[model samples]
Structure formats: C-alpha cells, structure tokens
Target chain A: MKFSKKDLIKLYTNLVRARTFDMLCTRLLAEGKFVSFYHEGAWGDAAGVGTATFLRKDDILYPHHRAHGFPHMIGKGVDPKYYLAEHCGRATGCCSGVGTVHALFEEYGILGQSAILGAQFTVSVGWGLAAKKNGTGQVVVASFGDGTLARGTWHEGANVAVLWKLPIVYVLENNGIAQYVSLEKAYPLKDMASLAAGYGMPAVVVDGQDIVAVAEAVGEAVKRARQGKGPTFVECKTIRVTSHGYGSPHMVDGEQRDMNMVEELKKREPLSMYEKNLLKQGIITKEDIEEIAKAAKEEAAAAEKFAMESPIQEDASILDQYLYAE
Target chain B: MRLLQYNEAINEALSEELARDEKVFLLGEGVGVSSLATTRGLVQKFGPDRVIDTPIAEAAITGCAIGAATMGYRPIADLMYSDFLYTAADDVLIRAPQWRFLHGGRQSLPIVFIAGSGGYRKVGPEHSHSPHSIMLHHPGLKVVVPSTPYDAKGLLKASIRDDNPVFYMFHKALIGMKEDIPEEEYIIPLGQAKVRREGTDVTVVAASYMNYLAIQAADKLKGEISVEVIDPRTLEPLDLDTILKSVIKTGRVVIVDEDTERCGFAGELMAQIMEHAFDELDAPIKRVCAANYPIPSGFLEKFVLPQPAQILAAIREVVK
Candidate 1:
C-alpha cells in the first residue's frame, strides 16, 4: 500500500475535479440551468475518489448522488454537456435527459446513482453476485452516506450479499449527518462498521481524509472480495466541508457540539494534507501539483464548453426509443 | 398451439429461459425455494447462483437486478405480489424503465419483474390488489398481463429476451390450471393482443384473469350473440391495432378487468377506443370492473372481481 507519486497526484486531481464539478453544479442549479438543488459528491469526495482509485478500471462501481466523482473519474463519455443536457431534461444528456444527477455510464461499468438511499446497495450486491457467479474476479464497490444505513434495504441487501459471498465492498461515507439530522440523532448504534460485523462481513472504520490510507484499506477489501472472501464494509469517517445541500439551514441541533473543532478540522483539509506530504517526501514537486490542478480546471472547463455547445435534447423525442423495441 | 394457463405458462417460460440462456437468472422473495411454486424447479436445474433466493427486500431485489442487467446479465425479479412493487417502485418504475434513456442509451436494462397481481384472491386487503395500470401509465415500461398459460409462457420468454425492463403479471389462480404447451420454445410478442374469439356483435377486451370471465360469458352467449375476445398481452405498448379493429367491426365494446372500476384497466381501454375507434362504435363503450373498494377476503372475494355473468350482462348492454 506504499504510495507512488503518480497515484497521489491522480488522487488529488480527482478531488479537485469533484470540487469544481460541485461548484459548477451549484451555480448551474441556482442559475436555472439544472433541475434539483440536491448535490452530493462535493463533501464526500474521499469515499468516492479513494475507493474508485483503489479498484481496477474494469471493476463495477455503484455511486449515489454525492458520489458524482466516481463517474468523472471513470472518464469521458459523460461530458459536461451531458450534465447540461440532463439539467434541461434533453436527450443530449448522458441519460438522454431522463436522469438528473444520477446518470450511469455503462461503458465504464459505473452503474447509475439512486435518489432513494440504500437502493444502490441492492444493485451493487446484485452486480457483485453476477460477477461471482460468472467467476469474473471483478469486484463491485458501492458508496453510500451514513443516513442510508438506517434504511431496511441496507440490512436486506447486506444479508443477501454475505449469504451468497458476493464480491462486493460497501463504503459508508459517514459525514455525521443524514440530510438534516445529525448521526447521533439518526442511529443509536454510532458505528456502522459494527453493524456490518453482524452480517459476518469484515468491517473497518478508516480516516477518510487520508486518501492513501483509504485506498489501502479499500485495496485489501477489494483483494479479499476478488479472492472470493465475500463482502467487506469500510466506514470512512469523513466530514462535510460544504453545506448539506446548497445554502444554510435554519434549524441547528441543540447538542453542545463544538463548532470551533469543526472549523479547525476544515483548515486541515485532506487535499492540502496530501499535497504537503507529497511535497515533503519529494514524491511530487509543487510545480507538478500546480500542473494537476491546472489540468483538472481545463478538463472541467472543456466539459462545460461541450455541455453548452451540445444540441438541446428534443422535447417530443423524449419518449422516442424509450422502449428497447416497440 | 396448446392452451396454457397463465400461471403455468409463466413458470414454463422461466424454466425454458434458464435452460436457454446462462445470463438469465431469477431473484426475489421465495422465488428460489419455490415458495409460490411458480419458480418451482429453477434452482435445482440452474443452481443457487442463477436461481437466487433474496431476503425480503423488494426495492433491493429489483434495484439489484437493474444493476446486474447493466453488467450484461438478464435478471428476472419476482415480487411476491405486485402490490409490493410500491416498496421497490423506484427500481421498477424509475430505474428499470428509465435506465437506458438516462444512461444515454449506452446501456439497456434487460430485467423483468414477475409478480402475481390483481384482486379476487382471498388473501385480504394487503395481498389481493391490482396496481398494474399505474405502471402501465409509464411509457418506457412493458406491462404484460397474461390471461392464459400459453400467453404467460410465450410472453415471459419474450420479456426475458427483450432488452428492456418488463412488468410481467400472472394471476395466482391460473398457475395450477393446465393448458397445452408446445414442446419447443416460442415467443408471444409484446404490444400484440390475441383475439381469443371473433365476432361482429360485440368486442370484449379482457386483462389477465378477467379474460377467462370474458371467455365464459362468450361461451354462454354463443347462440344469442357473438363475442370477440381480445387480450392485449402487454398493457403499456397496448395492441391497439387488434383492439381497434375488433371494436370497429363490432361497433360496440365491453372491457372487463379484475381491478377497481375507477381509472382501472377498463378506463384505459375506453380511452384507447375513443381515441382511435370512437366513430366506428355504435354505442358508448361499456365496462365491467370490480367495485371501487379494497378487495375483500373469503368467498366474497370472488364476488368482488368481474364474473362471467357480469361480463355477459355488459356484453348484452353494449350490443343492445
């Protein structure tokens, strides 16, 4: 699990890309370019980008709205124009404007996201089960927020996965909140890993901020899963750098939780920490770091250009070819 | 071609598809152990991996199937009852139907949702229900309600091969009722209606179990008036050609459905006829549907669903 300079840079760029994507999406939604204001993947980039980097390119991944980074990491067909088309409910979108934020790219095996929480777990398990049955050795990694674990489908999907010994990994991006409610108020059992243990699967809580550490943990889980050792649950104890949705919420938890500590942790951002370590170890120079950020910005800009210039998805044709064959 | 009961046809189709394609697999509550026995021996032949027995999670079962379909597997997820589809409607109504369009057609959701839907079974308020029409409203979804064993087998096989998410509903009562099934494989295409009987007096459009009542009523009124029985094999991509043709020829229509009368299958049929064949009709289209109430339990359950006598009366009214 020793890190390479290329790996660290690649990981950093992914987070950077995710931040840019989220910012753009927020702006787009506000400017009436997109549909909904619900944007994920911004705060929980580690859980998404880290697990994605840990697995092979051919491996299947299931992400939710917040894990939008997974699609961008898998690469190109889902252009920014696709996102724009999706906002307009136009055919040019990845889903031809049918899906909003939860577009799936099958070419990369990035099975789409679910607006309904915990639903992705079921789909991920099924993909893993199919891979296991075929002896493909490919693993399926699914990432969900802490709020989703409260759903019954979480337990049901996990039970089936463990029972069948499916090659799957469940990553819980525990950002300490379920939409509006704090984790403490949402669940009595604080640790989701402990709950995973009940399913007879190995569960671990990791520092989500440490991209390399998160990658190493996921690497072992993916290895075991590939080896037919069954499913594993990795609870990435992470933080939400941005607001829950777009703007500030009026209601605050009455608990005397220290806001000062939260602000202090924000100063110690994961992206900065990774950059500082890479610089000190001589794995990557400040110049290389700057280049990665510049490249990411260009990529985001190109995506935006492509989305804007793409033809508007037709309104009447929305139902065209909707059915596989009429 | 031998007549097969809708339930047995569906079961035979599953058996046949599992034998034909390795990529085809079954999942859901009680499907593997044959809890309902519709998928009785599938697990034995295909083994557990192919014939999966999932925990009681409809949303996951359906959603998981949608996911697996993306990975190039044809998944047939059985919801114990269509009523429970609401629990996992996101997978069925949202995910499966819209997957292809959402993914920019880079993928196809080759998944099937097989469930026993409709009222008249004595299982009470929860179990005895019909919600197929709601799913029928979704344009992308393929809603297949087989009224007989032959159509059940043929259409189920067709659905599995088709590269889309299909909602296949086979009435519970029709499973044990035997009909002649061919030794070789065959397919009943979706969006095509079967003309069970031909007549110029009146056209009777029946869905699922109600087709049997239409047939029975036809048999009793054989000498008095001829009844053209049309079963629109798939609900969403409705076989408008066959139905409109029959309605145009007869100049009268009677739609019989086991579901509630309001916004039921009957209403849909009427709307379709009015849209395409209204001028050809001599009289207003008639409907014989279950009363707008929660399906009851016990012997009265039979009374709640459309019966042969009620269908006959409706036919008489429409023809008169």
Candidate 2:
C-alpha cells in the first residue's frame, strides 16, 4: 500500500483535468456552445479522482450525475472525451450521441452515473454479487453525494450487501451539502460513516481534500472488498471548488470567502498538494511533472477533437438500437 | 381448448419459459416454494440458482434482478400481488426503464416484473388490486396484461425475450380459463393490441381478466347488440390501431378495467378512443371498472371488481 510519486502525479493530472473540463463547460454553456448548464464535482473532485486511481481497469465504478472527475480518472483512453461530448448533447458523443453525462463504458466497467439519488447503490451491490459469484476478482465502487443517503435504495442496498457479504465499497462524497440545503438539514445522522456501521460494515471518514489520503482509504476498502470482506462505506469531507451549477452561485452569497481564502484553497489544490508531496520525497524530477501534464493535455485535446469531428447520430437509428432484438 | 385456471396459465408460461431459456430465472417471495403455483415444479427443473426464493424484501429482489439483467441474465421477478409492487417501484420506474436513456442508450435492461392483479377468491384489499394503471403513467416501462392461456404464453415469452424491462400482469381469476396454446415457442410483440372479438354494435376495450368478462357480455348480447372486444395487450404503448378500428366500426365504446374507475387504466383507454375515434363515435364512452376504493375483504372484493354484468350494463348504455 505504498503511495508512489508516479501514482501521485497521475492522480494530480486527472484532478486538474477534471477542473479544467468543468471550467471549459462553464464557458461553453455561458457562450451557448453547450445548451445545458452543468457543474462538476467541484467540492468532490479529490475524493472522486483519488478513489478512481485505486480501481483496476476491469473493476466497476458507478458515479453520481456530477462525477465528471471520477470518469475522467478511470476512463479508457479517449473514451471520456466522447463521453463528455455525449453529455453535452453533441451528436458525436460517447453514447452514440444519445446520452451526455450518464453514459456507461461497458468495456471499462464504468457502470455509468444516475440522476436519481440512491438508485445506483443496489445496482452496484448486484454487480459485486455477480462478480463474486463468477469469481472475477473485480470489486464494485458505488459513489454518491451525501444528499442521496436519504433514499430508501441506499438502506436496501446496504443491508443486502452486508447480509451477503458482497464485494462493494460505498463512497459517500459528503461535501456538507445536499443540493440547495446543507447536509445537516437533509440527514439527522451527522456522520455518514455511522450509517454503514449500523449495517455491520466498517465505515471511515477521510479528508477528501488530500488525494493521497482519499486514495489510500479507497484502495484499502477496495482491497478488502476483493478479499470478500463485504462492503465498506467511506465518507469524504470535502468542499466544492465552484458553485452548484454552471456559474459560481456563491458569488452572490454575502457569506462568500474573501479573495485571500480562495487563493489559499487554490494553493492547496489537489494536484498541487499531490505534486508537492512527491517533490518533497524526491521520488521524481521536475521533468516528470512537465511530461505528465503535457501527456494529459494531449490526451484531452485529441479526445475533444475526435468528439467534435465525429458524425452526428442519425434520426432513424434513435430507436433501432434501444432494444437488443437482432 | 380445455379449461385451465388463470393462475395455471401463468404457471404454464413460467414453466415453459424457464425450460426454454436457461437465461430466464425466477426470483420472488415463495416462488421457489411454488406459493403462487406459477413456479410449480420450477425448483425441481432449474434448482436454487435459477428458481430463487427470496426474503420478503421486494426492493432487494427487484434490485438484484435488475443487476442480474444488466449482466445478461433474463430474470422474472414476481411480486406476489400487484399491491406489493409499490415496494419496488423505484427499481421498476427509476432504475430498470431509465437505465438505457440515462446511459445514452448504451445499455438495455431485459427484466420481467410478474404480478397478479384483479379480484381473486376473496384475497382481500391487498391481494386483489391492480396497479398497472399507476405503472403505465411512467414512460419507458412496458405493461403487459394477458387475458387468456394463449396470450399468457405468447406475451410472457415476448416479455422474457424483450431487451427492455416489462411489467407482466395476470388476472388471478383468469388462470382457470384454458385456450389452445401451441407447444412450439412464439412471441406476441409488445405494444400491440389483440382484437378478441369483432362486432359492429359497440366497441368494448378490456384488459386482463376484464377482457374475458367483456367477451362474455358481448356473447350474451350477440343478437341484440354486436359488441366488439379489444384487448390492448401492452397497456403502456397501447395498441391504438385495433381499438380505433373497432371503435370506428361500432361508433360507440365501453372501456372495462379491473382497476379503480377514477383516473384508472380505463380512463387512459377511454381518452385514447375518444381522442382518435371522436369523429366516428355515435355516443359518449362509458367505463366499467372497480370502484374508487380498496378491493375490500371477503365477498366485497367481487362486488368491487368490474363483473360481466357491470360490463354488460355499460355496453347496453353505450349501444342504446
């Protein structure tokens, strides 16, 4: 479970890419290039990116709707670009231009995200149960915001996962908010980790701002799951870097942080934090940082080009592929 | 061509489907124990892996079935009674049907939610109600109500094979009524309506066991009133063609459903007929259905459900 510089570097680049993509989306929507206004997991990027780094290519992950960072971290090659295009309602998107943000990459075992709060919980457990039955050695990760825990499916899924000792990890990105309301208003239980403890499963709360910390916690849970220790719940206490949607909703909030506070958080950015740690340990040179950033940008740029230049989905084929009747 | 109970037809369909496709499995309360008789001898045939008897957790069973379906297994999840379906509606409406659309059509969920609806032999309010009307309100969900043995077999096969999640509802009362069913496998495509009987006096749109009552009422008034009975097999993507054709021929209509009369499934049919066949109508549409209340315990259940007499009364009023 040793955390290496290369791993830290990879995780940092992905987090930066997630923020970059979210920033681009904001500009796109404001300019009307993209019709929908979407916000990334501004507060939950570290948790998403870090946990994703622990998942193998074949391991499955189901995300919440705002989990763009998670998909980018675990996506196979140029798939995330096409997926983003699809989410933006572009014709050349990953879901064959049909779905935008909730696309599933079956090849990479990214089970897609859900618009409904806790619906993915049971499905994740099901996938874990299937993998366990087939002896596939694959662990399933079901990630959701703190808001979704109020849903019945969460309890139903959690109870069954513990009952069967299924290989799954429930990731709770508790950014202290649930939509317009904060977490305290939505849930009576102050600690989400305690929520899973009642189901006889281990639950832990981690600092979601630190990529290595989030990664270490997720890696341990995933390892436990693969070893058939059943499901674990990880509650990450994090903050959203942007507003809930396309623009900064907090810009108008009188309780907004001053420029100095914003700058402080920026200095402690997930990527910068991970890079600084690796640099301090002398595990890598400055050239390594430059190469990774260059490679990540190139990958993102190529994916965007492919997605933008791809052909639009035909109108006639809309319903053709819906059912597997062939 | 022989008489079989409505429940028995469902049993036959399940047995045949499981035997035919190894991918098809049953998961529900008492399914392995053959509590509904639909899974009779299924445990012996497929064993525990396929014929799973689950705890009384509808949400878990439905959730597990949806997950299994995603892994390419065709799972038939039985809700012992239609009333119990609400326990798992989240999976049926939110997860099962919406998966493909949400995933940008990258995935398809092929699962069957089987449940018995309509008045049974005094099974009380919980056991006798039909909830397909409520389910039909949701898009992407396919609702199948089979009224006969042949239809039960054909539609059940179709539902098992369809890549989309389907809610297959059967009337407990119709299980005893048998019809000619071929041994070979065949499928009735979803979203199609069957013309049970054709006449020119008035059109009678009925679902599940109510269709049989409609047919019976139509037969009783054959010489006096030529009643056409149409069964819209799939209620969600309702077969408007057959219904409109019948309505146009008769220029009058009566829609019969076992669900509640107020904003029930019959209203959906009535609206469709009125909207598309308005110009051809000779009179206002009438619906014969269960009263706007719980089915009630004991004999009251029979009184609440739409009977042949009630359907005949509606037919007479529409035709007159």
Candidate 3:
C-alpha cells in the first residue's frame, strides 16, 4: 500500500505535534503545573500516530496509555487543549476534570479508557460487536502495550473476536516493558504476534520507529476489518526510550538500564527518523520540517495557556452531580 | 393474574425487554440453554445476533456488556452464579459502575448483570453464596434482590430500563417458587419496600430468600407476637424511609439476611436504623444472619445459613 505525498506530510505533522505536546507536558509535570503522574511516549510516537491517523471519525479507538494517549488522540483530530486541561484537572477538561489526563473524545469515536491495563481488551469486543451489528462498516482499533498482552482478557477477548469475526484491529505497541518489567522477562515469545495464531487471527510485525511502515501495516489491518475480515493483530516492535513514567526509576528488574543502550535507542527516536525519511523523499524539506516543529511548539504553548486559564474543579456539588445519571 | 415461576418471570422480563427495544441483547456462557433456566428459549426467540452465547469468560462477557452499553446498546450479561462474579469482579464492581462517573457522567451504561445467588441448591461454597454485601459496599451499582416471582418480573423490567448498571441477584432457592403476576406489563421501581405482612409489635426487615423466611416467621408468631415484615427489594437505593416509618410505628426491629453476619447487609441496615430512629427504639435492634463462615454444602449448610427459627428468635429478643 503506497501513501500519497499529502498522507506523508500529515503523518509527519502528527508525529511532530505528538512529540511537542508530550515534551511540554513533561516539563509542566516537572514544574508542578500538573498533579497527575505523566508517562512519556518518547520513541513510541509512530505506533500511536500511525495506528490512529487513517481511522474514520466513526471508528472507535481505545488508545494505549503511552504518552497519556497524546499521539493517538491528536492523530484522531482532537485538539490538545482539552487533553492538557484534563491532565491539569481543570473544569474545561474533556472529562470535566474528573479523569486526570485520560482522553474521552466521543465525537471522534475515542470513548474513555480504563486506568487498569489490558481492561480495554474485553471492552473492545463489545465495540466490535456493536459495529458489526450496526452494519455501518465502522471498525474498532484497540491499542495497548506489550505488557497488556499477558492479561487473561487478552486471550479471552481475542478468542471471541476471532470466533465471532468481529471487525477490530488489535494494535500492539511492543515497547518491551510493562512499567519496569522487560518483555523478555514477562513474555515467553519474542514476537507477540505469534500469540494471534492460536486465535486463528492474521498477524504482522513492523518497525515501530518508522512512521510509514507502521502506518502502512495498521492501515491494511484497518481496511481488512472494515471489509468484514474479522480481526487482525499488528505488533509494532517499539522502544520506550525513557523510564516507565516521568520521575520514576530507570531500573528494570532492580537493575539500572545501561546508559549506553538508552542512548542507542534514542538514536532511532521516531520524530527524527520520520523527519529524515520525509526530507529524503522530498515530501518535506528541512524548512518545512522546521515550520512544522515551530507550529507544534506554538500549538503546545497555546494548549498550555488554555489549560492554565481554565478554572479548577473544586466544587463539592460535583460529587453528587457526576456520581450517576438521573 | 397469571402464575409464573421465579426463573420463568425473569425469562419473561428479558424476553419482553429484547422484544421491546432493538438495542437490548443477552450474552452469557450458556444463555441459549441457561443452566438456571432464566434465559432458556431466549436464543430461539431473538436468534443468535440478539442472544449471544459466549465462552466461559466472565471478564470478557461483562466487559462486552459494558462496551456495548457505551455504544448505545443495552446488554444483559448473565454470569450463571453470583459466586462466579469474582472472576469478573474488576468489570462488575469497578469498571461498569465507575465508568460513567469517571468519564464525567457523560456516558450511561445501561447494563444488567444477572446472577443466581444464595444456598439451598447445596452447591457448596463457590456456587451458593449471596454476595450482595460486596456490591452494596460499592456506591455506583444498583442492587436488586427479589423474593418472589411477581417481584422478580417487575423489578427486572425496571432494572433493564434503568440507565445505570444494576446487579440483579436472584436466589437459587427461589428459582422454582411460584406466584401470580399481572397480565399487563408492570414495572416495580427500584428502592421501594413492600410490606409483606403488616403487624405492630416489631418491624422485620429482610431481603431475597430471607424475606420469604421473615414472612413465614411472622405467620408462625401471629397472635403470640405481632411481626411486621418489610422486604426491601433494592438494597442500594434502599427504601430507608419506609423502614424508618415502620420503625417509628413498631419501635422495635429485627433484620434478617442470608449473607454472613460480619459487615453484612443486615449490619448496615441496623446501623442506618439506629442512626435514623434511635429515639423511637424501645429495645435494642437485632440481626438474624448466616453465621460468619463460608456456607457449607448439604446438611451442614443449614448450620451456616439463616433459618426461620433464627428470625423468630431475633424477633422475640428484639420485641422483648
């Protein structure tokens, strides 16, 4: 599947925007501007952006918690201001300040996500069920980290997805770590896509650092799902260039990551790699790359300003108001 | 009025709901040939699309109901036995109930989780326990425990229509019990207490199968000791006002529950009665619940479960 020049630029713009927003949020976390814990997506931008960029507005998306879902939501066309405000616990947040950084853009088919890892696998089946029953050709894309695959719901949900042939694409961003545990330590299989065979679902593995590769792989899965080909498991072998979360230890299994390996992983950072690829293909010149970077920075600044200006949610009435629908 | 068994009434409710709305569907491990008979014959009426028989995966079944609910569909997930709820506790106790609140209350999960609860089938510890107390401890879930076929049909219809997540716990002991229900469609709103047997000496608050026991105990002690029985069908939206009104009239109360005594629904009701009507009490409130132990199977089960004799003894002690 070949992408047009327009698609390449859009993917590049999303990759840059996701990185800028993530960096700004990390800085804000360090400055104590936000109270919630931050998980930096770091080098996992291509997996998030590529998986979600081509999805239709009606297609449901359950984003992984990497970078607090900035890349996926941004790729799905949601403005970053509401996301920042949600993290800041401001009244104007997407969830009205209740969800601390969780994204819920219902209009773009991005419903809420669970704080419990891998809980979305079971729920994604229902979305797929609804899409199939609705017969509108609206596919569901459920993204999660490699660690989440170990959850029992993954097997149960996958079995049903294949058995019923639900229209869904299970996008696995294999970052090789769940919190502080490495994938090699947690999972027996090096290629997580092999697990999909037991469910009789088709599987693919891609270079997550390359935006075009990730996009092409996920785009084909999405197309297959839309065509009623049941579900597909696409494992993007990615890397977490930082600790599990901001301000957390860089240790995995009580051993500090070798600084050299960390530096080596950072060398293939998604934004820079995608930028170079675009420049080589003449899809975007160095000047265009700088312009995109500047615009992303400006957008991040405006989003931060909007979040800072929003009112804090401290009213006691919200306790009862949001507890249950009348 | 036509007669229906407790399980049959539940089947009717599910059938009516599925027929009434296109969005309503049923999914469970054996819903096509339900073991409890609550969902039997549903698959044939609704077909495979509407009546989904899923694998034995509680978390997946519950999560599918919740997920489908969010997408403008009402899903009724039947988890054969209430004891099996532990397998899907995360989705039932946390996700389904908290999903709406955590997401700013913008979404409503119109999902119903049906499970057969309590002992009498002698199904042992894993299969025969009534865990409504665990659900009551959680704030977001609406709990319904019906004692009779009439109440079962009415309350289930109401639970299906309710916008929030409702845990409908039917007693396994009462599955074969029969009673008359109106031919016309009727829905008993949640949180309403029904005065089963009216008396003046003591107010007996009970639920589910215990409500049936309380009524029997009240009849046995009739003329000797007048006992007023109040069955609170829904526990979460508890009809505390009705119980308080009865407490104000009788001035003495005894709560009966099949769940264990420690931190049970009976204890919670006793505390509320004490808090609201402490001044009106003429004697100390009493609770007749199962002993604080796992319900053993067979003949040993009677020792662990609450009996009618215990209700009588508690009533006598409270009225004194």
Better of 2 and 3 by DockQ: 3
Regions more than 4 Å wrong, model 2: A3-5, A67-78, A187-190, A251-268, A298-326, B1-4, B120-127, B176-192, B274-279, B291-304
Clashes of each: 14, 15, 0
The sequence of per-residue lDDT tens digits that candidate 2 reaches over residues B43-103 is: 8887877787766878878888777777777889888888898888788777787777656
Candidate with top TM-score is 3
What tens digits encode model 3's per-residue C-alpha lDDT throughout A1-326?
A: 99999998999899899999989989999999886889999788889999888889999999889998899998999998998998899989988889886778899998889989978889999999999999999999999998888899998899999999999999999988888898889988789999999988999999998888989999999999999999999999898888888999998977998889888888888888777777887888878988988999999999999999999978778878777778
lDDT of 1 by residue, A1-326 (tens): 77676777777777677667766667766677666555545545666677776566667876645635433443222344465556656556767766666665566667676667777777777788778867879888887788888888787788888988889988888888776678888888878789887888899889887877788888889999999999999988888655566654523365433677667758656777777877898888778877877876787677666666766666665457655644
DockQ of 2: 0.49
RMSD of each: 2.8, 3.4, 0.9
Name the weakest run of 10 consecutive residues (lDDT summed) in model 2 chain A.
A69-78
Candidate 3 chain A least-lDDT 10 residues: A315-324
Tens-digit per-residue lDDT, B1-320, candidate 1: 66665555677889888988989999888886664678887888888778887778887788778878877899999898888999987778877777776566667788889888766558887887778778876667888888877778888888999888898888876666777888887798888888998888999988777887788888889999998998887887787889888887899999888788898878977887898877898999989888877778877776677777788788888877
Instruction: Choose the strongest candidate by lDDT.
Output: 3
Measured with C-alpha atoms, the lDDT of residue B49 in candidate 1 is 75
